[model samples]
Target: MSEQSVRRPTQKSRLARYLIPIGSMAAALSLIAIIYLGYDLAKGRISPCEAVFQESSIGLKTKISFLKTEGELEIGREQLAELTERAQMTALNLKTCCTVLDAGRVDPEQFLQCKGSARSYEARLDDIAALVRTAVKEGMSTGSVATTAATAAPTPPAHVEEQIAQEVEAAKAVSRDFNKQVVQVRKEQALETLQATPPQNVTIGAQEREPNSDLLTTNGLSLDTWVTAAIGDGKDSDYFVFTTPKTYRDRIRVELQNRSTTLEPRLRLYDASKASLGDRYNTTTGADLSYDFVAAPDTTYIVRASNYYGESAGVYLLRVTPTKAYDAYEPNDDILTAKPIELGSDLAAGIMDGHDQDHYRVETGDAEAQLLVTLTNSSTSLRPQIRLFDASKASLGEQHNTTGGGDSSYLFKAAPNTAYYIQVRDYYGDAAGTYTLTVNEAQPGG
Candidate 1:
């Protein structure tokens, strides 16, 4: 349109043109701003705490993935699976905490909880890393050994092989040291957690009752309970006494968990007569002490806890538990201490360890009797073996099963009024298990 014919452009038209474009531009800027704010908020940028938590959660997830891949290749499958499960659980917890914080919930308790979870996750990662490192180093050493053994034509010099062995040993030592450090850190963390929150399902006993340095004034402890106490100073000792259960044979475990960084725990066990049964001490700093024994029925036992160096003063937790119930006859590991068994009796017992041997004494009547002794394996790993011995501790005959979880029998003529011994053990001294030994008169002309 011609300017003259249309006359000068109206101010309204000019304003309309500029305002329409400006309005459109303003709307576009608003939309962009909204998207930016939403993205920033979603990424947990609302607060410093939320930001830190979000960062931590992402970092933990990444670390866990790496650990899972590395652990599967290096560590045992079961161990790796367990670690992975724990890591996943921890990651879920961290993510939940981060979400809560991101939602602008300012709860001090929740914040503390998240902090604790973070610490736990870090500790777990450290432990997994240590395990993987150890496994990798061990694998390397094994591969080196195999290579050295297989190389024949291009054999390395003796000194070179020796040097390789030395290097492998050094690597092992480093791995061991790293593992120890990780163990110490975990122990310290566990102690802290325990102190912060006492365990459930446990009767919290009293603190150290002074003058518990002797049997007469010792503190009494209960089974499946925790006792929190402290050592005052050098030469300070804490004594606890408990009665064994009335069960025929009880496996008792005494544990001492150190609570202070400066304290190294030492545990000593004793009987009712104040005779020292045994002792255990922590070999590393911040390690726990544990001692186990098979106690006689309805007997009193004493446990003494003291600092390893008898110097540093700190807090500790002591607990006693009956771990297992053994058969009526135990401590009969040799012919001299053989338990007496009656004829036509079947007895159940266990080989407590690979090196354990059970002995039983059988007495014959006034007439010659043919005895049929049968040993039946009760554990899948045990290959039963039976040995007959005269009263003079001389072996008469022996029979054993060729395979595990099998039975063995022996037939012999018993003299009148004579004491004979029956010994039982694992065919190979490497498996521990339970078995039943039966003694009966053999049928004649059947």
Candidate 2:
């Protein structure tokens, strides 16, 4: 196996002369050359192209490694699930964002600038969406592999971890930028498409059907907080939550400030399954809708909003007061936080990145170290128990997580930007502590 010398013909010297998008090929050609050079150096032979291809192939096959983890978390089916879910989320979300801008609400200016931080705004959500799609495709493949390992023969693949590590590393680096680029492109021009006339109604031997329900629906919920017809309408107070878990009787109220205005807005919510619950509000101006939960909780439902759609002119609040307990966190769980934690003044907007909300970025490296956090004690007496749950959905057989009198220590892994939940168990004859947790990855995982 020798690395072939890379022989990329220059774009300007292409045999076929056709205009093209330069940035589109920039990262790819560069990646190919870098990969080729590395391959040749590694094999000490001259077929770099083959080496690069081999590396790519190996990366694909690495997901869902059948080997046992020496200890700690994982490189298993869960990772794939997470990746796929991310992909779907990104895809759907990106389409929604693009649709909004096309509809004439969001400004295109965010993407025109070039700073990474600048790109961090709504402009880069497309990149995250793309990344999610890639992750999902790979995740499905990973699931298949895991299933095969679970039932088929016991032959093991070599260095699956290393292969996967390389892929994950590469994936993280580009996903955000990809999403950002999409936004940037949008910013440079108006969605000229929005100006196009709506489709002609060719009645197909059918009575006019109910105006197709706006594609957005809150089946997962029945009631939600309506801040106003438009968000940020000079008045900032608007919010709500799921009144009853699994009970989809939405109790929250929304008062649209500009229902008379032709604004189509989107409302997003999350059920216990971590599924997205959304509704598109096409305006005649605006009307209020209440969302109720449809299922019981092994989890908590979360809510947030976006205005790529027209109704974005006003504030819509989705507010919920927990009549039910904040059971998502148990009394004894140790929680990790987001480093460069997104600073939000209040829970109304927990945190948002250029790509999404409720999620923040962090860096990780090769070894697990103590995690960074700030904790607050809530109960007068429940001491917290920190437990380690692995990707297999299996609790590590031997490692008992740290137990705390009130608060506690150390992050548990080295998977760069790897996410893990801290299990806080109700403990030692004490009331639970409501702690504020923050995590900073001293190094990003590879």
Worst 10 residues of 1 by lDDT: 152-161
Specify the poorest-scoring 10-residue window by lDDT in model 2: 348-357
- Per-residue lDDT tens digits of candidate 2, residues 323-441? 33233222121232212233121111110111111212334445565544333444344344444444333443222123543554344543544444433344332333344445554
Per-residue CA lDDT of candidate 1, range 1-446, in tens? 78775755686689889999999999999998997678568766455545555566556666667666665554446645554555444545455544444432544555465556556556656655665556556656556766578863233344444443443344334334444443454455556655766322222375666777755567888888888988888788888888888744566889888887777788998888889988988756667788988666689888888888887778888899988756668768778879999999889888866677889999999999999998888888888889999989999999998687888899999999999999999888888788888999999963
TM-score of 1: 0.38
RMSD in order of candidates: 20.2, 30.0
The estimated TM-scores of all candidates read 0.38, 0.20
Clashes of 1: 0
lDDT score, candidate 1, position 1: 75
